[model samples]
Target: MAEQPQEVDFALAAYREEGVWQVQELAHDVLENLEHVSSALRRFPGDGGAVGMVAYDEDVFLLVRVAGPTVRLLLSDITAADEWDLARDAVEQLGLPYPEEDDDPAPAGDLDILGDLGMHAMDMGVLIDDYDLYPDEMLSDVAGRLGFGPTFDDLVGLTSA
Candidate 1:
């Protein structure tokens, strides 16, 4: 575990209720681990459960979907486990071994996490493969495809007033 908690660029929970999408800014402390994210997400009354998007240290991002007792996760960079406790917890939850420091940066866990919401696994993979984009950018693109880009952008301060 790190002596200091990881810095979060942003942590948000998005869910749809009554046919409307709602985005909420999650507290930075939710980035502690998967359990915290899941617990926080359960508070939302989203029609299909709630989705959590957290970007840490600008090095990796974690997406968590909590519906009922089921929780699915996706970490943008598997190798991040080497330095981040949240990523390590994610890798463990996915039943994956920690990657070697020299291993290539790859996304791990449920690639089809958002399939039901309309972002297919193939497209998700493509977005993860785009190294040019930061975690926030990738997540913003995801929000757009899922029909809540503007709300996500505004919450993350990506939108100009």
Candidate 2:
């Protein structure tokens, strides 16, 4: 069997600062809890709102958006719902039932992380359902939708070449 990846791979947090996108990353331990992630994101220094994406290797992905005091979340798989703290917190945030071991890793919860930035909920659903794409690609699509594809790609060191 392939070795399982660590629960949290990496997290990217970005927000518009003075008309430019400012991006930063968080450690895995920080993602093991929600309040820590919140505290970290709030320090980005931006009035244009903040958006973040956390990928748990090939298993799952979590998207978080903070606009002022409101925080929104999107988890890629509900089957692995209770497997990690981020997923567990997401379930609690949505008041969702924890998925069992036999459950399929279907995209769960909603993807309104960028609704205020112009990504429609229905469109996010479609992107989330495109199983052919991996977390980075899906997030890249999201970045594109949010008008930060290149900037985000650059921050994450992803190149289309």
Candidate 3:
């Protein structure tokens, strides 16, 4: 049998320190874990590049690319206990399929890391969607509808309000 390294678990414990559960910290930890797992998995059969992030509802998730698609995994959340239950129920209602097998290696599910950071749900999508909440058409339409002038910036901002 091979002995696994204890160092990663030690770092994970440190990263998830109690009362220090900021969303960014959580996301960074998730990402680190993802990189670790993906790299380890690379020594095996499939590609090794799974990634993790926190999404709109204080949800921590793992995302893995498979067959050219991104799969999600819901790891943890800082939201109400019932929130995850509700999301899972909604997904079942929507007929989304659960992962097929452990070896299949797909992402878990959508998580609400955004809510953990106190941002609106749409803001979570903005963060993951490459920081562009308003696409070109949507931006133009909203600007026209609200009679607002166009504003442009180099990078999309994700600061908590």
Candidate 4:
């Protein structure tokens, strides 16, 4: 078994500054959980989609972005052999746990059926935590944050009302 990835102290510090105690703890727990669950996910052809740590000068850096069930390390100059080694090492040494994969397709991204503002709020929270987003920006301001422009407001108006 491979060893678990050490927590990112800086990211934890960011959590302390930007989030409450519960939020920080939840983020920590989710990330730790992801580490284990990454195993058993189909790799994207060789080590392409394996969830393993990337290093700079052989020192770990960056929390390598994971998309859906895919995992990719952010290291440079690594060969396919090295990548496979890292992937297997993470699964075996760190004891990564994966959610049981089911053949069923995921549901649509809708919570309107919940038919309550509270349920919408809960769904929003789930979306925010699952992916990185600009916390300080409003939905109307998201495009501006991403360098798209203030036109996002116009787009929203056209789509909704």
Per TM-score, the best of the predicted structures is: 1
* TM-score to native of every candidate shown: 0.94, 0.85, 0.23, 0.22
What candidate 4 gets wrong by more than 4 Å, as runs, is 1-7, 12-26, 33-59, 75-161
In the range 84-127, model 2's lDDT, one tens digit per residue, is 76778877787888887888777666666677777878898888
Error of 3 at 6 (Å): 19
**Cα RMSDs, all models:** 1.8, 3.2, 16.4, 16.1
Cα lDDT listed for each candidate: 0.90, 0.74, 0.28, 0.28
Model 1, span 1-161: residue lDDT tens: 44435477888999999989999998767666789889999999999899999898877899999999999999999999988888899999999998997999999999999999999999999999999999999999999999999999998889723
The residue pairs in collision within model 4 are 1-92, 1-93, 2-92, 2-93, 2-94, 3-93, 36-96, 36-97, 37-97, 37-98
Residue 15 error for model 4, in Å?
16
Q: How well does candidate 3 score on lDDT at residue 147?
A: 26
Tens-place lDDT per residue, model 3, 2-101, is 1212111111111112323211112222333344433332332222222222232222222222212333333322121233332343234335553333
Q: Relative to the unseen true structure, what is the C-alpha lDDT of residue 112 in candidate 4, on a scale of 0 to 100?
A: 28
Model 1 regions lying over 4 Å from their true place = 1-6
Best by lDDT: 1
Model 3's lDDT to the true fold?
0.28
TM-score of 4: 0.22
Global fold similarity of model 1 (TM-score)? 0.94
Better of 1 and 2 by TM-score: 1
